[model samples]
Target: MMRGGSNVSDAQLQQILSDVPRIINDPKTADVLVKRAEELGQKLVTERLRMAQARDIFDELRQIESIWLREPERALRRLHLLRPKLAYRRARVRELGPLAEVLERAVAEVVSAGDAAQRHDRFRRLMEFMEAIVAYHKFYGGGD
Candidate 1:
């Protein structure tokens, strides 16, 4: 049986957040990323987190990633803004539950990634992780 916290018993998702950089560095990382996300997706489904809730959060993250940055500070400001937006979203969509918990960890990682270069890398990995999560969430039958 699945074991760990209600969100993800062992904080596997949290590990995935912190491991993004190392995972990106590994020569054999690509499939590892997908495999990990797929496992998390199954857990998400088993926990009954809904697809819409996950997608809505992803949309906000995507918007942040897609913005053009003439000044790097603008991107950081946006990232800072996302934290509260996520909090408001989680409060509104209680069904988000563990998924929000997981996303929050990722946001924390991105915000504290230490420097501009590292932050950008972490952000991309965060996007990849969430994209895989959303795709696998749909693949595993998560729905409204």
Candidate 2:
């Protein structure tokens, strides 16, 4: 389970558990991100993803990037903070469903990467994933 993400109900937990194997070996992380990022962006469009929510998460990502440049270890801690927020926001704003799902996956990727070097690589993937999602979201006329 992700740190501070204990709020997942039994149903959601079951769904995620079932997704684990597919998520684990469906291709390398970078390749999967490349293939699915656009689809996720489009999914957000279908979900009517809110601009304010996207902006807030994006801004937090930027902050995490800056912290990463300065303190690599601390950056990981900061990244972990997103788990709880994703859970909370997903509950409060239904439109955040797709966005929260993708973000949660990214965080899980980073958390399970196993070591500092691996985590760094996963973090880069996470960043790239979000950038692609946001770009495609805007391209798809996703608006507030």
Candidate 3:
């Protein structure tokens, strides 16, 4: 049975149980920024899917690169905080784990690899992962 006060009505509260680190590390104020982050994350996901369907690797990479490069630390920080939380839920962890790895790899490759095409491919894949991460943040209303 659900207990009063112990129950959080928002679906995001369920996500918060896992995303403790994200809650701790979020720069956005708990009141104002978290909701905004969540919305932004959710919105980017549809954009990513549309780009993927169109086979628009260049466009996807361009968008992701802008976000990642402009805020590498923030991206990294978000991932760092999210990975462990997601890992706790085996099924969801399985679904999202590879994406996390892909994003991490893409960041590394983009930062280190000199080959233009390879970097572009990595960045494109990274977009998929970023979208998912953003979706997660969206689900949480930012930090949860």
- The global C-alpha lDDT for each of the candidates, from Candidate 1 onward, is 0.71, 0.69, 0.39
Compared with the true structure, what per-residue lDDT tens digits does model 3 show for residues 49-135? 232322232244444467665675554454344434434432443433333332333345444435545444444444543454454
Tell me the TM-score of model 2.
Answer: 0.76
Ranking by TM-score: 2, 1, 3
What tens-digit string does per-residue lDDT give for candidate 1 at 61-119?
Answer: 77778772455667778778877877887787665655676667667777786688777
* Per-residue lDDT of model 2, residues 1-144, tens digit only: 121112334354345434433343343645555445556565566677866678889888888988886798888888898899989999999978767876777688777776887777667666777787787677666788
Best by TM-score: 2
* Regions of candidate 1 where Cα sits further than 4 Å from its true position: 1-32, 68-71
Q: lDDT ranking from best to worst?
A: 1, 2, 3
Output the worst ten-in-a-row residue range by lDDT, candidate 2. Answer: 1-10
Error of 3 at 39 (Å): 18
Cα lDDT for residue 141, candidate 3: 35
1 or 2, greater by TM-score: 2
